[model samples]
Target: MLLERILRFFIVLIMAIVGGTLFELAVPTANAYFTAPLWHEEIAVLGLSPAGLLCILCGTALGGMIGYPLAPFVTGWLRRLSLWVEAQLGKMPTRDVIAGAMGLFIGLIIARLLGDAFFTIPIVGDYIPIVFSIVLGYLGVHIMVRKQQELAEVFDFIPRFFRDMPRVREARVAPQAPAAVRDGQTDRQYKLLDTSVIIDGRIADICETGFLEGTLLIPVFVLEELQHIADSADSLKRVRGRRGLDILQKIRKESRMKVEITEADFEEIAEVDSKLLQLAQEVGGKIITNDFNLNKVAQLRGVSVLNINALSNAVKPVAIPGDLMTVQIVRPGKEHGQGLAYLDDGTMIVVDGGYRCMNEVVSVEVTSALQTAAGRMIFAKLTR
Candidate 1:
């Protein structure tokens, strides 16, 4: 409401100024053509002709009246157009947006110069600048967006040029600290937390132990996903989602490490995993997740991934061949005469020829332990 009033005031003020100027310009012509005594008569109070003062007053009043009604419609239209532009920009990558803006500025400058050169041409002269500006501005944006990567490379020299400058004098006076060191301490790495790791709830525990260092970076998109899950119709999904949110809150409040929620998101990327990879690259951070597929994909993309499942497996007690251990077979395996059991930390132990021992604890000799991306599996046979 306040904004609308401000807009209305500006509109009225501008119209009144223009109207007064126009009336002032026209009054001389009127006085010249009419050649009346009334036109020539000056007012004693203000040193102006009575007709000129009256015409200016009427013009200002008319302009104010006209502007008053048009303000609301113009304001509403501008608000909607701004919203649309914001939405469109949000969908584009940051690099592309920057490049497009630069291109638009350059295009407009060129258009202005070219437009002025042809300003002397009759009839079409006035429209030429407008047409040129629209066409060039659009071409600039399109071309820059399509070639944003190449443009980024082109601009890469700016940083390199600065970096290559000699700092021998500064070094002699006072040596600069290394990038990794802050106040004589090593700088911690940024550990970006993914949804799966948050939901799994081990990250908070790990953080509490002070094993994990660096800032716990949580992206806004990951938080949104958690909220969506928390609001899910399914009870299990809702619980998991709520748990993730709770874990995040606890980590933020209790954890010693810096906790930051980044608004950085890749709208161009559809998959959350892909976005996570992109974000990792952007921030030079490692992703913390429990997702096997995500870990593999991230590794393939050369992005560092810290998988909770893999970490769990790494920390578990190593079970080698010929090691004797006792296990309870809770269920039969796919193979005949084989039973399956899980270690305390959820490691799968396949008990061969122990089908009859289902629902019972028995001694078993480990045959082998195979390690995979998901986890570790131990193969064993009944000792009895």
Candidate 2:
């Protein structure tokens, strides 16, 4: 309310000044043309004619009355505009904002240079620069923002001293090796985490063990998907999603590697998995996931994938034929006279001729072990 009043006061003051200036200028002209006594009649108190003073007062009053009603509308419009701009700016990343500002500055400079050349042109001369400024500014912002990544890449080729030069093409080296490699440094690749890996909650343990290296990147889209799942109506999905968020927090707090949440997104790609693949390809990073299908797809696309399930299987203790092991026959197996047991690590142990030993812990000798896509299985028989 106070802000509105302040805006109203400024509006009224400006309008009154305009109205009074118009009236004052007209008074002398009126006296010069009419020779009226009222127009020339000076007031002893103020040293101004009654007609001029009265006109100025009426102009001020008219201006105030007009401004009084318009203040609310003007203030509300300005408030809304400011809010809209703030929202837009909030959504844009810092890099994009900087690029857009630079683009706008360059566009305005170009417009100013071109505008002077056409200033002498007839009727449309005044409007030509304004049109150029608008069109060029929009084009500049669009081009700069859309090609910001490419622009960054191009700038990388230029030497530090020559970076400030206007002629960038002359100073740039030929595109051969990446900037990092050319400078004799190996850039650490990002390890992007997907929703499935986070939900599985084993990746946190892996990070804690110091096995995974490089920065751990979590894209905003993946986070949004987690949020959606967390808010889901299904109790199981909500729990899983919440667990994923918790795991991410734990990883951030306890993991040795750096964790980053990126705002990068692909609007055209609808699937999160596809986006992850595309992101990995673009950033030259690898995807760390427990999703089998995603792992296969990423492999097909030539994008590197670090499968958590694969790693778990690889690290499992190996069993060989003739190896003696103890097991508890929890239940009968599908085959006749076969009993099923499980290792502590969840590897299935099939014991032949041990059906009678159900619910009993017995000694068994391993005959063979079969490795399947799912996991490892040990086949053995009961020992006397």
Best by TM-score: 2
List CA RMSD, all candidates.
18.6, 18.0
User: Compared with the true structure, what per-residue lDDT tens digits does model 1 show for residues 346-367?
Assistant: 9999999889988999999999
Across 176-292, the per-residue lDDT of candidate 2 in tens digits comes to 223332344446578899999999999998998888888887888899999999999999999999999999987865577778676667889999999988877766789999898
Weakest 10 consecutive residues, lDDT, candidate 2? 174-183
Deviation (Å) of 84 in candidate 2:
59
Task: Return the number of clashes found in candidate 2.
Answer: 0
> What's the lDDT for all of these models?
0.82, 0.83
lDDT of 1: 0.82
Clashes per model (N, Cα, C within 3 A):
0, 0
Model 1 lowest lDDT segment of ten: 176-185
